[model samples]
Target: MTKTKAAFNGKRLFIRLYCPREFKPKCVTSSVPVTRKVSNRASKRIKRLAKPMARPIRVTVRSGKWKKVSYLIKPGFRNKVSKMAGKRKRLLVVRDRIKAKKFAGRKFKGKSRTVFHKHRVVSGKAR
Candidate 1:
C-alpha cells in the first residue's frame, strides 16, 4: 500500500509519500511559521530624523578648532527642532550627551562611535 510520513526540518515542514515496491517516493516541503522577519520601527524613525540634517554639526575640538560630527536626534521630535529654528532656518545639532540626559532618558542608541545627547538649532551664520 501507499504510506506517508511527515517531519519538521528547522523552520520547514517536509512530507514524504511512497508506495510499497513499484512507485517512487515523492517529497514536499514548505516553510513553517516558526520564524518571522521583524522590522525595527524605532531605528527607521531615528534614521528618518537624522537624514534631512545631512551635514555634520560643528563642535569645538580640544585644539580649539571646530570639528564636524554627524548625529541623530531622538525620534518623534525632529519637527520640534525644525520649529525652534523658526524663520532663521538653521542647521540642527544633536546636543552633547552630557547635557542631553536631563531632557530625556536613554536618548540615543546605536553602534556608531558618535553619541547624541540632545538636540539644538543653530543659525547658519554661527559656523
Candidate 2:
C-alpha cells in the first residue's frame, strides 16, 4: 500500500511519500521561494533603469584542488547581476522614501531619526 506523511516545523513544512515497508521512500520540503511583487509602473521603471546593464562580462578564475583551472562566464552575465543588485537597492530606497513622506510628522515606533535622515538624503531634500 502507499503511505504519506506530513510534518511542519517552525520554519518549514515537509512531506514524505512512500510505500509500506520502505525505510526512506521520498521526502519533499517546502522552502521560501525567491520572488517579489511589484506594480506595473515599478516593473517598467526597473526595466528602463536596468537596460544599460543587460549584458554581462565574463572573468576567469582559478579553481580545483590544484587551483590551476580557469572558468569563463558568459559575457554580460556578471554585469547584469551587479546591475540588478543596484536596481533592487534603488527601488528599496524609493519605497522607503515614499513611506517616509507619507508618515511625515508622525512618530514611528522604532528609531525614526535615522529613517528620516535617509529619506531626506534619498529625496535630495537634505540641507
Candidate 3:
C-alpha cells in the first residue's frame, strides 16, 4: 500500500522507465538516468503539488543500483479513504480484501514478491 493517491497515478509514468529492466555499463541507468539526484527532483516536485491537499502526501523514491524489476508493486487502498477528503478519487478504491493483515503477495512476470505495509492512513486528528 502507498501513503498517497498520487503515487498510483505516477506509477504509470515511472513504469515506462524501469520496467523490463536491463543491465548497462557503469555511469548508465535505465538507458537514461535514474540517480538519487533525479529521484530527489521528482520527489520534490510531487511533494510541492501535494501541499494544497488537506493532508500531506508521502512520495518515496528508490535509489541505488538499477535492478531488473518494477519500481511499483501493485495498487492497494483501504476502505477508510473512500469517504475521506482528498484527490485522485478514481484510484483510491480499496483493492485489498483482507483486513488486519499487513502482508500482501504479488506475482509479476513469474516473480513473486511480498509487500509489507500498513494499508490504513495514519494521521493526526482532522481540523
Candidate 4:
C-alpha cells in the first residue's frame, strides 16, 4: 500500500548572499550557509544562488585517468577549440590533462574530470 504523506508547512525564506565569482571568477557552488531554516531534504539540493559569492572557490578534480588533448589547430589557431588552445596546439607540441567533472546533463550522475576540465589544459595550467 502507498503510504500517505503529511502536507508540507514550509515557510519560504529568501536569503541573500554575495556572488561567488567575486572571490574566484567562474567558480560556482550549491549554496552558502544562511540563517533561514530549511528542510533536511531540501538542504541536500544544490543550486547556484543568483547573488554574488563571498569567497573564491578552492576546488580540484581528482581522477586516475585523463585524456591527452591538444588544440585542434596550428600555431595561429583556427576553430574555437584550437583558438582556446593557443599557440601550443599549432606549432609547438601540446599535451594537457582533461579531467571530467559533474555532468550538467540530467540523464547521468557522478563526477568525471575529463570533460569538465577540458578548457583548463588549453587555457594554460590553472593556478
* RMSD to truth, every model: 28.7, 23.2, 16.5, 22.8
What are the models' TM-scores?
A: 0.24, 0.15, 0.16, 0.16
User: Judged by lDDT against the true structure, how good is candidate 2?
Assistant: 0.21
Clashing pairs in 3: none
Best by lDDT: 1
lDDT of 1 by residue, 11-116 (tens): 2222211111111121111111111122234566454444322223333223212233323433444444445443444323331211111112333232112232
Residue-by-residue lDDT tens digits, candidate 4, 1-127? 0011111112111121122111222222233211123332343443222111122222332333221211112222223222323344422111111222233322222322211111111332211
**Per-residue error (Å), model 3, residue 5:** 2.7
Name the candidate that leads on TM-score: 1
**Residue lDDT tens for model 2, 8-103:** 222222221111111112111111111132333466766344222112212221111111111122344333222323222421111111111112
Model 4 ranges off by over 4 Å: 1-10, 20-22, 32-127
**For residue 75, what is the lDDT in candidate 4?**
22
What's model 2's lDDT at 14? 25
The order of the candidates by lDDT, greatest first, is: 1, 3, 4, 2
- On lDDT, the stronger of 2 and 4 is 4
C-alpha lDDT of all candidate models, in order: 0.26, 0.21, 0.23, 0.22
Cα deviation of 118, candidate 3, in Å: 7.4
